[model samples]
Target: MRYLPLTETDRSAMLDAIGAPDVDALFSDVPPGLYLDGPIEGLPHHATEMAVEKHMRRLSKRNLAAADAPFFLGAGAYKHHVPATVDHIIQRGEFLTAYTPYQPEIAQGTLQMLFEFQTQVARLYGCAVANASMYDGSTACWEAVAMASRVTRRKRVVLSGALHPHYAEVVRTMAKFTEDEIAGASPSLTATPDDDGLIARIDENTASVVVQYPDILGRIPDLRKIAEAAHAKGAKLIVVNTEPVALGALEAPGNLGADIVVGEGQGIGVGLQFGGPYLGLFAITDPKLVRQMPGRLCGETVDADGKRGFVLTLSTREQHIRREKATSNICTNSGLCALAFSVHMTLLGEAGLRALAAENHRLACIASDRLAKLPGVEVLNTHFFNEFTLMLPTDTRQLVRDLADKGILGGVSLGKLFPQEDALSGGLLVTVTETTTEEDIETLASALEEALS
Candidate 1:
């Protein structure tokens, strides 16, 4: 049974009504050469459900799961232990079936959870307030840059060379339509800063300076100095944290004078479900800038009888209200994922989170120390959290492939993302979470030795 809702006559009539002589007229705006010459090769006009399911399953089988092999991969998305209870609680009918709360009065529980989630994020980042959540770490970082520019009323955005490549691309894409000036610091996988200096580029016209915490190379920057430099030029400092677990032991980005702190909350409660549906934590300093922040914010309020209740506040800047003038067009909230984060953090508490963070750092340090002893392999980061970059004597891409064949999930290859660039073409960035065990570290170390040898 074909499921075509419209008949040939109906299509013709609709096209005629729209004053288009043919269906091809609808796509007149698309250039001739750009038009597809034929249909896609693999896709069929029709297929059985079982065939489609089998095809999808076969394609999925090609992918290597994190648990399938000794895994060690993290630039932004991480492999962390998500307790079964977190999944159980989020899957409840009431919470799982809920959507964005348009009516604050009827959505007390949802609003309260969001409010508590905001509080947790603010405390973790040392900021005044946080939104519910954004799309992901990259999108959140992009929004932070845009918000900083709007707040400072400036045109220039300075991107650190050490910033994640994907994150830098997102910012560049957003800046294109606004015609804002974006200067990128030189690209390098090495932890140490070389000739291309971004700190020297800041001036009065600079709206914001963006740097990543435990950046692409897994080296922690002296953000206090960078923040001071940006402030001296009247620019807001937007700090990005792809891995938020590092915050448990490291100085909060807000305390280092960061105007905005943005990061992926996957390490907290979200699962690395093949890099999807992760929570983005966005926080800012003063209450004045709260209006410019993206996403919904939940606040405590009083009912008509003076009883306390929670409600969605300052939603006028969302897509539902301002339309084109909205601070963010985002509508769907990572509500369940955010709830999972809150629940996990509540269970961990401050001390437990700190201990978990320390354990991650310890594992990573041991792994780096062991791997650095191998010939032709060098540890490039002096200061880091749970992740770091390694310089390989051979091409990192080939080394990674070899390691994968050996049943070891190797770190991300720099050359894989930046193929044209020379600096990062030979390096690989590795991460060790609290979930990573000593045996995992040994396997990675031994696998790298065999792959290189």
Candidate 2:
């Protein structure tokens, strides 16, 4: 039997209080076509826990598990080895079920963990402070742009060609309703824009300029000059990083004079579960701009007893208190994923992370060198952390499909991501993480060569 605690009389009384004649009246503004005609088909009306578990288990067998394959597909998401300890700590009863740490008295542990995670993120990105976390890297990118607009009081934003396409799209979507402007350059394998370029597009009206570190194509550029140019025009420089692991070896964006640093935290400890359930790492300089920071921030303090304690501090801009006037409407961040990131990084420490990053770069270079030697393949990036694009002689879409038939997961084709851009149809962006081995690269290279031939 199913149960709904809200009695029919209780619901009707509440609806009458709101002056809504019926539940359908509450949805009166919804477009006719947008509403479903009826209930979804084939869903079970009722089931026992055991029966549901058995049904789900059968359905799960049809899905492809990442562990079951020698996976290499990383356009933005990646596969890395998560230590056993990460999952162990994350599954602890307190950490696993703990939601928002709103109450400091009872939620001290959860708040403290988030505070530590924020500190680690700020240090990693070389920013002054970090919020708890956001939905994922893409949303954080959008939030950063919005924050920049507020700080500069300017409406226009300049985006580098090196920025990820998905991040760019998300920003544009978010900015559509706002009184802001966004101009971005064409996507490319290299950070160097065409002579008629990204710098030329910046102006006094520009609120911020965004670029990616070890960008979408894995080309790492010295953004210091670009940041300087934007600063001259009174525009803030926001840098997005998809792979936070690269920060262990590469110069931190804060060192490069970036005003804001945002990225995906999945590379640290979280698995690439389809897309996500990943954590968004957002940080910034200047405490003056801290009020505009999205998401909750956990701060350290002392209680009445005077022992060290942590609480959700500086939350004046959230939806609860400020409503539409809030800096961001974001609530309920990725708490579990943030815990996974913190636990994983705690176990790795600075030394382990750097070593892991070094291995990733080394493996990627090996893959690039071998793959470049293959017929009709041209390596595009000169300095890359762990990923690069290969300009193939044959159509990449056709080649990748052939490789997939052989049970080998191939990299993403540029054409698929940017369908309107025919010029990039032959370029394929491939990524290699610490988990990839020589055997895996060789298999990919062999399969790619066979497919191309």
Candidate 3:
């Protein structure tokens, strides 16, 4: 029952083949004092199943779940009410067991779903094409930069100040081994985003200008202007969208001339399962860049019988292509999450999506109006879909902790996002969706007043 695949003789043979005396010899470099000899300090050797279950239940009770609090947190991952229908569909036997479509003949259902998902994403993003899906938004942002570097053959990337700090860091981290040069700055604590300043940073050497729509600070930047400037300098415009719901109300970045659009698709259908297995959306408005895009692209086609079907028309992942020629090294796509998003989008048709967006903005405006009346609080953005930055009179990081102590999942603090930037210290990023109620907003407002006073 204890499924140990290898016998001691088998292990010894392998270790001997590798010229090791024993397993302990394998870890010769590890400090003897640091090595554990036996049972860890004081843990019980064993426990009854019921006892363990009870212990776990007690531990879980300490966690302040999003539903149990006045949740306002959203930088990348969001808290939205995913319909029961989304779950029921994704849990089907066919979808639950679906994996990479190595053979299209047997995976018609999976392929067709992916094809439909891609179509929905393409239309949602206003792009000519969208990949099946990627890891998550931050990594997708990095992929966009790498793709831009490939298309333009330039090494310099200019990042907007308002771009998500996590996304920017991911780009910088990935750029270490590559020749790409990243030019980035911390966001300014103002209602207006520095579009002009960002444009000035773009030059002939720039391969891409990356900007986030409904940015980390919750202020929307003018993507069209940024796109035009990037084009003038022969640089691709990479737009990152963290909140896909905002797109229902705001113009798609692709419509504003973004060359490559990458973002987190966690806002729809996907519940924030404590950070991940979220979906990443990557698309291209310019069809010319399709060959250079990452991940798989499912396209409609026919088999030997000539009946309409679907297949992976293009997969540039390293698995399906020569390592040197592959567009991306991603092992697999986020298939299940993509299915959930597609199903949710299908349920919320065009009208439902718009109505959802309207309610979000309506509630957000109400929260903003109520909070702005506080003695030292100021809502920074003059316009926003559902999320915005609030400049607090006190240190925001401490205030957030204080709010959390009161069982309220307060907004993200700029200090936590960009710790080194003193100018951004007091900023708080608050998000509001239909799930956030008028009472929740009041609870937060009352809590903020009491704390500030």
Would you give me the overall lDDT of model 1? 0.86
Decide which is better by TM-score, 1 or 3: 3
Q: Model 2, which residues run further than 4 Å from truth?
A: 1-43, 189-196
lDDT to native, each model: 0.86, 0.86, 0.90
lDDT of 3 at 12: 86
lDDT of model 1, residue 272: 85
* Candidate 1 lDDT, 1-453, residue by residue in tens: 356788888999999899999877888989999976677788767788888899999999999888888888998898888788898989988788877776767778788889999999999998999999988898898888888888888889999988888989888998898877899865655556431366788889999888998788888888888888888999998999988789999999989888999998988889888888999889998878899999888888899999899888888988788888988768887898898999899888899889989999999998899889988899998888998888987788888888888888889998886776776778988988877878988888888887778
Q: Pick the candidate with the highest lDDT.
A: 3
Pairs clashing in candidate 1?
none
Q: What is the model-wide C-alpha lDDT for candidate 3?
A: 0.90
What TM-score fits each model? 0.87, 0.89, 0.89
Q: Write the per-residue lDDT of candidate 3 for residues 84-118, one digit (tens) a residue.
A: 99999989998898668879899998999899999
Candidate 2 clashes between residue pairs 3 or more apart in a chain or in different chains: none
Q: Evaluate residue 33 in candidate 1 and report its C-alpha lDDT on the 0 to 100 scale.
A: 91
